[model samples]
Target: MKTDSLSAKAKTRIKRPPSEVFAAFADADLMSKFWFTRRDKGLKEGETVKWYVGSDDGAFAFDVLVKELRKPERIVIEWMGQDGNPARVVWTFEESEQGDTILTVEESGYAGSNDAIVERALDSTGGFNQVVVAAKALVEHGVEVNVVADHVP
Candidate 1:
C-alpha cells in the first residue's frame, strides 16, 4: 500500500509511565475500563480475540488476531471484518522527555478509496484519542474521563 494514501495521524500524550500506558492496552480489565466496550479473553502474543460493539441490538464487531506483542513498547494486531479482508492496527508506546509516555495508534489497510474507509478512519481517530485521554486521567489522577460527554456537543 502507498504511504501517501494513508489517512491523517492522531497523536496523544498520556501522563503515565511506559509500563502503565502499555498495560492499559495489554490488560483486559484496564482496556475494558478505557478502550474496549466489553471484556474478552486476555491479550497475549499469537492469540485470537473477538469482541462486539453494541449492547443487545447486535451491532458492528471485529475479530482481531494478535500479531506481535513487545512488552511496554508495541503491539501489532490484525483487525478483520466478518468477510475477512484486511484491516490492521499498530499500537506503539514511547517514553517522553518529561517522563511521560506517548501512545500512538496507527490503523490502515482499508480496501481502496472507499468513502466508508474514510469515515471509519475518522471515527477510529476520535475514539482512540478519547481512550488515550481516559487512560491518562485514570492512571495519573485516579479519575476516568468521560469521552461521550466531551465528544457530544
Candidate 2:
C-alpha cells in the first residue's frame, strides 16, 4: 500500500521569530511548556532522547533520534511510532521578514493495510495541527492551551 509514500504534514504561521519559535521544539525544557510534557535532553544531531507526554499517571514515552538539527530552521527525527514501527518526523521553520516564522511538521512511515496507513496519517495530521496551534499559543502568548494533552484520556 506504499506506506513509504504516505506522509502527513501540518503547518502554521507563528507570530514570533524563527529562533524563538524553533526553540519551543528544539529545546527539551522549553518544549515541555508548549508541547510534549517532558524530555530527557534537547534535540541535537545524531542524539537520541526520550520524550514523554500525557499526565503523570498516563505518561507515554518515546525515543527520538535526531537525524538533523539546524538551528532556527529545521529538525528531523526518527521515533518508534505507529504501533512500534519506525517513523520519521521533520520540523521546518521559515522566517518571514517581519519576524514571524512559518512552521511545518511532517511525519511519515507505518506498518498496516492501505486503510490503516491512511487512517494513521489522518490522525497524525490532526495531532500535528493541535501541536502547532498549542505551540503558537504558548510561544507567542505564553499560554498553554493543552491542545495536545487534553486530546487523550
Q: Which pairs clash in the backbone of model 1?
A: none
| Per-model lDDT | 0.71, 0.84
The lDDT of model 1 is: 0.71
Deviation in angstroms for 99 in model 1?
A: 1.9
Candidate 2 local Cα displacement, residue 150, angstroms: 0.6
Per-model TM-score on C-alpha atoms: 0.78, 0.90
lDDT of 1 at 145: 62
Off by over 4 Å in 1: 1-4, 54-61, 81-85, 146-153
Backbone steric clashes in candidate 1, count: 0
Question: How much does each candidate deviate from the true structure in C-alpha RMSD?
Answer: 3.6, 1.9
lDDT of 2 at 145: 78
